[model samples]
Target: MNRKSRWAAGPYILWMIIFVIVPLVLIGVFAFTTDAPFDENSKRLTQEELAAIEEEYAETDEELPVTYKTVFTWDNILSVSQYLPVLFNSAWLALIATAICLIIGYPLAYFMSRFRASSQRLVQMLIMLPMWMNFLLRTYAWMTLLEKNGWINRIFGLIGVGPFEMINTQGAVVLGMVYNYLPFMILPLYSVMTKIENHTIEAAQDLGAGSIRVFTKVVIPLSMPGIASGITMVFVPAVSTFIISRMLGGGTNMLIGDLIDLQFLGNAYNPNLGAAISLVLMVFILLCMSITNQLDNGDEEMEGKML
Candidate 1:
């Protein structure tokens, strides 16, 4: 690159190193570090206790057990079983939410793409409008709307459905995820669909392909890149999001993010475990991105074949 371009990128690279790269490195280090909670009478060393030992290792007591020794032991790695359930649950929830978003968002995106410019602008405005307000506020608003005695329940009561529970359920968690991430799905798909060649669709129809055939064999294939992009955008954040899950799903819905939070701030007090979980989460997202990129490449190959 030219000198000016290199200079322009220098600040961003430095900032990234100072902020993102440094924090990630620290997290990885802490992941490997020993971290356990303090116990007044317990014979075992906690994570915090282990960290303290390393920090004060220079104090020199040949009698005291090695802090780094126990901290990086095989037993500690095996102890990650406690976090597995949460990780599994988080993955399951994210997959379900992504599938639901794909189903709903594809249709909306298609509609938005096919509509007139003025109408499309209005629809886009409606979709983007929710983002103007705080996301947490929107989740809280849904809580109020879905509570047993909330607006929906009151309407149901009039029809004799009476006291239907909505808040604090798995359904509530899914609802929050879909509500928050639907736009991510729609926007990508819409952008792809809007750029789709009108002539190709018409040509397919002219060649005796029905509407369904045209959609499935032509439009859908062309839109695969957008679909993959949307899924990655929605699924990654959904897996790591704790706020909506905590507020909507309540006690029953325990996700990986919640477990990570508890490790750092809650009862777990094992920042090592939190760091481990975060690293694992990053790996999962990397996998998702890899799959999406593969799909995008496949789409490009197919597009090349079509041309």
Candidate 2:
């Protein structure tokens, strides 16, 4: 709040302006610009040179005058409709992964929160252990396990069930998203759940509430912040994931992330389109966060009214 505090924040302000704000501005510029760069050489040509070239070419009709300046265009953004399938696939899969994480994570967090402090610490560490490894390496390990002759199939063989196709499927991609993002869901829930005092739940039960009623009416409403945070953490990355779908889904189940990658780096090689896709994805994520915030705010209001 003082001059010294303002000075301390200078570096962070400069860092955000340079890295975050500038890049977003550039992406916005690129998204609205034509893919082709303006050719300065064409502008530099003299009228005489142009006339000579036209005469040599001997066109049957008058050629339209062309400008050699970059112009804003909406084609890149509008073209996103062509990739609707990929976009839908990404949204649908990300939603499934987020739902799965919530369903599995809430109960896990609730159970873990009831443990002693020492045991809770151990459980938290165990939940976070897999995250210490590189994400790419972890996804690759899943690929190895899901492949035709992978460990899963070997286990199935021992059970006389033989191998079933697992890798290169939509289910595999969703599984990878859930596996990687589950901890994001669990940690937030666990943190919030641990902060809930036992007295609150006891009071709810004393009021003749059943276990489900206590959880729904007391525990869940209190933990809405964590639920919102976890959903955002899990859903955003799952929606934008390219590597998991590429490696585990074998490139067959292309998501919006893959479409964006292809535009910038793959055969498509269109940065303008990539920027457009990125902008749309950013808007979608912001919308999701906004909805989550509304839900969290509603829960807080309801909790206040109850109190």
lDDT of each: 0.85, 0.90
Top TM-score: which candidate number? 2
Q: With candidate 2 superimposed using the best TM-score fit, by how many Å does residue 291's alpha carbon deviate from the native?
A: 1.2
The pairs that clash in candidate 1 are 35-47, 36-46, 36-47
Using all chains and alpha carbons, the TM-scores for the candidates as numbered come to 0.84, 0.88
Winning candidate number (lDDT): 2
| True-structure lDDT of candidate 2 | 0.90
What digit string (tens of lDDT, one per residue) describes model 1 on residues 1-307?
5667778888899999999999999877777767434334545665677677666765776434542232453333456676788788888888899999999999989989889989988998899899788999999999999998999999998999879779999889989999999999999999999998789999999999999999999989989989999999999999999999999998679888887888899987887778878887888789878988998899889879889
| Candidate 2 local lDDT, 132-234, one digit each (tens) | 9899999999989999999999999999997999999999999999999999999999999999999999999999999999988899989999999999999
Candidate 1 ranges beyond 4 A from true positions: 35-77, 304-307
lDDT of 2 at 82: 85
